[model samples]
Target: MSIELNEADLVSVSVGGAIAHPGFPGLPAEPYRLAADGTPFLLPTFGGIVYNVSVGDRAFGWAADCIHPGVSIKGADDLKNRGLNVFSCLGNTAVVMTGQAQGAKGVVTGKSGRFSEQVIVHFPVEVRRKMAVGDQIVVRALGTGMEIRGHAAVACKGLSPSLLKALPKKVEDGVLKIGVVATVPAHLVGAGAGLTSEGGSLHIQTTDRAEVEKAGLSSLRLGDVVAIENTDSRYNHGYLRGALGIGIVGQTDGPRAGYGPGLTVIMTAPKGELGSFAAPGTNIATLLALEP
Candidate 1:
């Protein structure tokens, strides 16, 4: 059966920003962050054109922390950057407006850092190689006002209509069943909680390595769609019994105590209208046909 959405009611607008420079938290020794094991390490974090990594790679066991693949962009003004972050949804089309890769297209994959307020876009490796920091990128942002027709309980957050269609889902017994790589329990839901779900991500804590392995999330890859159990993300990322949320793995696993692989919410239902089934190879790279 086919699911319906109010596609015509949605408005697609342009939100632009320049490729951002990777930032340091301004610690006494900037650019150095200690792992959960108390080891200081410095590796590429977020921002700018990342030609090597893409959406399909593993999210954990990486040398880097909070890695955002492809290009990360943000507006110069703080308020405008928030606009760029909030408006740019996953699967939105992004285009290079300036520099050597002018007119090259990419796909919005995720959003990063509360302070950085940037949108992550995935481009072909060759296209990324031609990009540089400060190059302008304009996203044809849509999905904020999207609604699943005939399914009022299933609310969408930052999921484009095209992506919603591309996702592997079916109506089973009056429930929307979606395929996910993993299902994260409410207790594992960490950072970004109590925050708006319109943008940013909710992390799955990795402090307990054994628990991560037990949950079958040790092999999680960036862009993998996941289900968060007992969580209500319709408005904010918070815990609610019997609630279910669906999100995309947005960033890599981190070494921080409360931070790990983060997930950007796409769908949530407080009434348990959303269900899931195990499905491998269900990442955005495959669903959206994203080029590395």
Candidate 2:
């Protein structure tokens, strides 16, 4: 299916072009980084909310702590038509209102943010520097896909806030951090490959085995928001070709051989911030109360 923005991609944002919001902070004057390699790049964000598993259900070794940030830009009225919008929470309004992407425009498709950060806005390779964690871009909220897909959306056709609210609530970390969590040991993390729920499980990758042990594998339940660190991460974007969430797991082609693990971020703290808990094997540096 060749994706194209029809009316579905055309959320007007403003009722008739009056400007939906004054907007959060506009695009940054200078983004910290851009895709030097220049593949079909996407900024990672939290995939949105899910529920904690129960006796019949299980995280099944997935990153059971946090919500994957949606691949959002800013808010627009007709983004729902473009097949890009997904809504969850009263804060869905806050998402489009937060950064440089706010009021601006882009496609909010991939739900990233498990261990990754950045709202995973898929740009045309020209707009990378225009956005950053602090910068606000514009997003067109689209509708939800299917529940089996495990994503967030406002569209009545698929996963919506009701579905998001209805999930199990597997884990709870009262705090929410902004940036990615530190890496954990490869051995200690539970289980997640490159794809599941279209790569929704990407956030569980970690580089700290000790943190895994300390966090207590059993202590981890689905839907918990854990943080992660931003490293080379050994991830590949091509895996996402016609695929979503592939970047989260760093799935190049086969099984991840080196440091390919995911983490559940608790929240979004400010940049240069630290986490609040110290797991056994990871080097998170500090434990902070975060909000993302």
Candidate 3:
């Protein structure tokens, strides 16, 4: 199915500077463990160019709570309230309007709001080098009133028509089955909790080596679509048994005690409202035909 957007759906935002990673505040004598040699360290978070990573890479990084290739609109409250964050769909064009990279173009990879609302974009390493914080970037926000035909219960958020078209879907026994790489339990969810799904993401806890191995969280890669069980992310994230949240793995976190890969919500619904089948190839890279 095809959806159209009008002029009113578009909005623009300024690219803000990278957010420095503040070590766990208030922790006694080094909040967490250091390297094997007892050297102190902290993981990179928001802002700046992430040269070594891209859209389809694994989410595991050496830096804790790291957010790659961060780009945000300063004072995003107005845009967020008006659905800029919600409608700035993935695969949307992001054009650099200032700095050395002026006129450079990139693609919106995902949306996140761990500390504040921001849109994560992917640009070439060389272009990223010339980009600076506070650069002007424009996005054509377009994902509103999106729906899955014959499935009114399923709610679509932060998804672009281009992204939707790339996804593979089918009807199975009267249930709309979307392809996903894995299904994660709600109990394993961390960070970005108590946050509205408007423009945010939740972390998949991977601190415990045993739990990480058991849940297969370690194998998760960026862009993979995973089913989150027993959670409602329509408006706000909450415990709702039987609810399911289908999201894309957006960002990788360092081996923080409680943080791991981040899940950016794409579609969500109440219990028994939607179903999914394990399909490993159902990822942003595969759907959009981007280099893996």
Candidate 4:
């Protein structure tokens, strides 16, 4: 047996939803949800901006000595395990303290956490730098991973335009089930899922009929973990497909053709696997010959 990596960094970036501050203008809705109340938030998106890094960049995703090596923190190694990072706050109503506009607080939007010494808050750049590094950030984590129960990442190997084309056209609708949780938009599938050898599952696809036809899986990258399962599984049930044996997620040219906004399970599963995390009908507990 091998030893599991148990190194939970001393400090993890806190994340939360944004809540509209009192008397805040614009869309009069609660942007800062309970996550602003100081709860645990998980899953940071790739190439997303936190304190300094811009959206769609991986400058600060790793648990390294220097977290956000650009804007927030000057030196990455210096801020390895410090007191705290302001970006830790995920979603909450926040007041801009420093920079050009001071005291002008806005609802703390989504937080970019996970090993970032410099936290990422989703606020207008003009007013994001309320607190500097080591400042207090708030967040409220709700529910649990169970919220996405009975789901799995679609795994693949040696991803390429050709590999994606090889996927089953339709396995007879009732044969397979797919689970799509926290799905990202299919139209925006370019590079959203990296082509790493991890788990190799692609668990999501485009519901936009037109996009699926022209784009197909060609837009998807290798090692992309797409979610798939059966219908009637839950909120993400219809997302799970039983048609093509395991459902359709990536580039395909077959009978199944309805793609929708879905989650990118690429990170959850291991490298070079076919499918990770079984869907609703999948014998979750039952051992399978294909499991890694």
Candidate 5:
């Protein structure tokens, strides 16, 4: 059966911001963070235009933690940045409004940070090269009020109707079956927990390599769709028996104790109405045909 949603009623509006530079905390005496192994190191963390990385690339081997691909954008004003973060949905179309990359189009991939607040956009590498940190980008924000025709139990959050349609899903016997790269056990859910799921993401803790390997999460790629087992993300991310949450790997893996690959929650069903299967090519890049 075809996936039907109220795509027409969703209002598409403009939410724009300039690229943000990588942020730091309180001007730490030493701009270094301890890895899971307790090794102090520092590298590119988040924000700015990442010229080399893009969706579909492996989320590991990078010298950075919580790294975002393409252009990371946010309004200079804190309140406006929140608007940009909350309104921009995954798979929304974005366009460079000013600077050398004017008129260039992109896709909103994800949102990150608590206080820093950024909306991640995926642009072609060449288009990204022409972009600068202060370049303004306007996203055609939609999908916040999407309705999945008959599935009242399934709540959609931070997901575009376009991306939802592009998702590998099927409705069988009233259950929505989705394709994901892996199912993250509830024990591994960390960071951004107890926070609103409308924006931001939850990190999949990779401190225990053994556990990560056992759960088949060691090879998670950016933009990869994955299911969080026993997670209730209707309002906030928390553990609930028999609940299931589906999200896209939005950021890179980190070395911090409770930090790892961040997954932006897109769909959730409290009573396990959402089913998932191991699907290798279910990444956003593949589903959305993102280039560069």
Candidate 6:
């Protein structure tokens, strides 16, 4: 799975200012409450490296929006958005190029959202402490021009060669089997719809307790790989029967109208792109030998 790309595919970006938490002003005067007696508060949305938490934790915070650290690039048009979101791969190196934490390094974890064109980066606690709003963070985007040896139909997006190599893949009979912790139904897919494969995430709808329980989505852990049925994530998120998308659970959020746990797209293809199979035990945590 070693992939080679020309210099033309690589790009860099400057970090935009941290997005301030703009409270939904139109809501009722009473503080938003969760589970009736739960804490009443406002939603904490985007920006900053959220430390002390990782995947697999319960989305228990009151009014917590996207529960992940994010960095955005302002004034990004369609082309720049694609370059930052599509070309950038998970596990790519991110370096703080300006401010007090200059020279600090981190890893690209996932993309935030289409509207913001933000990229999530994970740095050490100390490094994050030194970072501030608008601090320049440069990423070595390198996932473009990738192909899975003989599987041309199986499109690879936002995944590094090393990640592909580490992913638990096998050929059984004539079909390629990709291990996944769960198989999510298309109907349960929420949020991130209509977004491009570049730097975007698909939210698992957890508002329906039955659906969540039936899909076994409650057991999903951060970094766990999951397969989404009827999802064509090659370009934009779309509905195409029999299409399959394999993604990593990147972030979690409390109950929202149309959002839930966030999944970052790693590999995807249309129907018949490749023989698809799923099973538990395959996840980025296991592949990278990191604790979940």
User: All candidates' TM-scores?
Assistant: 0.96, 0.25, 0.81, 0.26, 0.96, 0.79
Which lDDT tens digits does candidate 2 get at residues 1-292? 1111232342334211111111223586432222223323222212222122211122234442222222333223344312222232111222334444444343322333222222333332233333443344443333223222211211122122322332222222432112221233223333433422222224342334455456444343222323333311123211211111101122111122222233312121222222233333221111111121
The digit string of per-residue lDDT tens for model 6 on 214-251 reads 88877676667788889998888888897888887777
Candidate 3 structure lDDT: 0.69
TM value for model 1: 0.96
lDDT of every predicted structure (CA atoms) = 0.88, 0.27, 0.69, 0.26, 0.88, 0.66
Candidate 2 local distance difference test against the native: 0.27
Q: All candidates: CA RMSD in angstroms? A: 1.4, 18.5, 4.4, 18.3, 1.3, 4.4
Best by TM-score: 5
CA deviation > 4 Å runs, candidate 4? 1-53, 56-119, 152-292
**Which runs in model 5 stand beyond 4 Å of their true positions?**
26-28, 114-116
Q: Encode model 1's per-residue lDDT on 233-261: one tens digit a residue.
A: 88888999988999899888888877898
Query: For candidate 4, lDDT tens digit of each residue in 110-195?
Result: 11112222222334454444434333334332111211112233322212222122222222222222332122333333222333
lDDT of 6: 0.66
Poorest 10 consecutive residues of model 5 by lDDT? 110-119
Candidate 6 residue spans exceeding 4 A from truth: 1-41, 55-63, 69-82, 275-281, 289-292
- Residues 1-292, candidate 5: write the lDDT tens digits: 4788888888999998999988777754778889878899888898999988888888877888889988899887988888888888999999999999999999999888644378899999999889998999999999998879888899998789889988888877889989999999999999988888878888888889899999988888899999999999998889999999998888888788888888888899999688897788789998899986
lDDT of 3 at 262: 78
- Candidate 3 residue-wise lDDT, 1-292, digit = tens: 2333332444433333231222245746655545324556665665545666777777775454556543444333554433546666777777777779888777777776564456777777677667676676776556666666567888887777678667766676666667888888788888777788877678787766677778766777788888888889888887799889888888886555446677888888896777788887577877776532
Q: How close is candidate 6 to the true structure, as a TM-score?
A: 0.79
**Residue 188 CA displacement from its true place in model 5, Å:** 0.6
Off by over 4 Å in 3: 1-41, 69-83
